[model samples]
Target: MKQREYYFDNAKFLLIFFVVFGHFIQSFIKESNSIYALYKVIYTFHMPAFILISGFFAKGIYQQGYIQKYAKKLILPYIIFQLIYSVFYYFLYGKSTFNVEPLNPHWSLWFLISLFFWNMMLLLFAKIKPVFGLVIALLLGLSVGFVDWTTSYLSLTRTFVFFPLFLIGFYMKKEHFIWIRTKKARLTAITTFIIVFIGFYHAPSINYQWLFGSKSYSSLAEDPFQAIFIRLFFYVLSCMMIYCFFACVPNKQYFFTKLGKNTLYVYLLHGFIVRIFRVSDMTDLVNPPKSFILIIAVSFLLTLLLSSSMITSLAQPIIELKITKLQQLQKKWSNLFQGYKAKLFE
Candidate 1:
């Protein structure tokens, strides 16, 4: 088996941590300017960087059964989670009626459906020259905003809006990432992050929803035509922030590095905890400044917990449609039990 690169793994773990942290602080964005700025800063890159990395690994599109493979991997889990979240929200919100609109993905589930689409898109987009493909993708992404109907239903908006990054990632070679890891790039990345954060802190009028890429220009601005420029600006900003994020990711492996492979588990499972936290009075307790430190710690711990073998083992069936991890975990416990029994008998 080929060895996994620690650099990508490190990048994934860090990005997923940011994803969790971003979701945790979202409830408090309205109450704290600093948190709001941080939220904007995070949203600018987290998902885009993730999508780019996802694209980077998508070089296997030509392999046999690739489409079928991802369909089972992404679509199956998306369906399962869509139903789960629907039922979860039904009970959590105590709604008058139960509704399951698979078209409308709940919260963070959009990534699954959109990811599948991005891979499918590579069938066509990958055929074009990289530059032309990217330009076409950008134009399509910008044009889609005018068609007000291109909302989040089936994640169509984001599928197009973010496809350029995905295409860019697909075209990227290993050497490109190696170049970003240079000391000069790291310094530039740190400076970029600081400047962006400060800029966001001062520019409260810049709506964070622009970073979401979910809404249409019609809804977000007075003039749809002008909003295209705003969306273009964000596309540029997101790409810059994405490379900056990549530049900062350490290439060395760490304790949490292996957990990066299980990010799907974290992405799918963390929602339950975050949703419950959002609805509960817990948000009131996690006020900004000092409390945010606690939120950060909790986010890291939550990411760690969800990525642990035990959680992955339990969730393997639903998420991966496999029990290999579960069986290993079961055998591990059985061995421990047998060892304890032998000790007692002795």
Candidate 2:
């Protein structure tokens, strides 16, 4: 019998779990410095890995002209969830969910704005050459360090940070993207990554209070020479580790996979939940071990449960109807703003 393909399950599960685990540790594991250190180590890899895996499966979006399709899939869902989460965040946290902007951009919602630009770039540049497109991704990612993080969202930096990895996923060749056969390259990349990552962890983060400190965001760069090579090196290492982890993973049912499958839902819903629970001092219930473990476990579990219910449980039928309606709305939006060229003309 032919084995069934699992698509990106293992990697997706890892990514979803990391997002929860990283957030929990950042918030709840503060009592232990050792735990905080470990949390930093874990987070160094999460978003990059997620972007790479996203890139790996992106080939289809290149063919059959999935630009419109992608807008619906990623953009619409992003907006839908951002509005929903914003309300929940304020309710939960009892404070503003975002730093005040001149025009007031949502704080965490920058991920959506960044990724939307990324997908658009990929759709445009992937046509030139995959590697060229990857170059564009790097340029976009690096643009972030140059901006004032407080003043506004740096879509360029976010783009540079993630788009290459996304392309790595979208255009990934099973051969080179793997490690078993390319042991030397993978090992070299990983070894360099560890040494450099340690350096970055300790390398002076810019002084935030100084009037000129924000300039450090741009002028200083990732240090030890802030070039494209260093950035690519880390990107490769993250992707390799992800590849190796998935390749060696033992098949087992994991609740996180359910969560990953419904990442859009959690991405949309969880921030508000965090805020709501925080406001109630329910998060204060996370007093050291009990609440620490409780919030971590409950956050992942609840997000998983809610997302699964939306996608698979009795509610999916109703939810699917909603999705269909939204998709139509999405179509209208796509038609209204058809292309960059049209925008210029109008």
Candidate 3:
């Protein structure tokens, strides 16, 4: 197996924790001010940072067999999970349709679909000059208003908005992150985190749309020029917080490395648990004060539980299908077809 970067693994593990934490708090956004503020802070940079790290590790992704590997690991699992979530949603909400739309991803699963598109487009992105690529990605992201493709099902809006962050990671060097360990860099990073955390705490409930990157600029109903600036500001601020988050994270290997390795499993499986919480009215059933603390504690515990090795091991058979067997079966069918054709010609 290839050696792993401890820092990136650590970051991935923590980022997935934030994902679970954020989802858990969504149910309680109106229950507590502190929880709402914490949710905003988590949303601000979690996905951007996660995508950046993905791009960082995706060096040389276009190698001959990579597309095949991604199809098995990313695409196949995306389809399976999408179907699973669709069934879960239908049962929970009593939806009239069990539609599993490939183009329009279900909630949380959007990351998987977006990731697939990003990897597919890697070859195209590699052809552009870095400066030009960055400009185009930003412009396309902000110009979503011009396009009326909501029914496209391909997650075009998010794919464009988050594309720049992915490229930034693609261009990032190990030495770039090394500077964060320096005394001055540490001071600056810590201070920035303080300021941002303070802002999140005192600020009113933020329209999470700014960070979600899923809405069109026109839909926001702000002055066109002002809307453009808001998008740019969120992007810049997210980059800053992402760096600060990495700076503060431990670079040394830890027990969570295995959890990081199986982030895809945690990511896909945890949503099911969260959905159960929502559908059962678990959040509404609980009272404030004691129940609030219980929920917070449970959230962290759930995150840890979801990332545990036991959970990963138990889910592996489902997560990693026996594709080798399928490949052999396909080869056998092809051979039988060839034999039939040759015999007929003779």
Q: Which digits, one per residue and each the tens of the lDDT, describe model 3 over residues 21-108?
A: 7887788777777666767778878899999988887777878898788778777777887788788889888899778777678887
The true-structure Cα RMSD of candidate 1 reads 1.5
Candidate 1: pairs in clash: none
Q: Top lDDT: which candidate number?
A: 1
Candidate 1 displacement at residue 25 in angstroms? 0.5
How do the candidates rank by lDDT, highest first? 1, 3, 2
| lDDT of candidate 1 over 91-132, digit per residue (tens) | 999998999999999999999999999999999888899889
lDDT of 3 at 306: 71
Name the candidate, 1 or 2, with the larger lDDT value: 1
Query: In model 3, where do residues sit more than 4 Å from their true spots?
Result: 1-4, 285-293, 323-346
The per-residue C-alpha lDDT of model 2 at residue 300 equals 60
Q: Model 2 — which ten-residue stretch has the worst lDDT?
A: 206-215
In candidate 3 the C-alpha lDDT for residue 345 amounts to: 100
Q: Taking the tens digit of each residue's C-alpha lDDT, what string does model 2 give over 73-99?
A: 656655555555566555555665543
Question: TM-score for all predictions?
Answer: 0.97, 0.67, 0.85
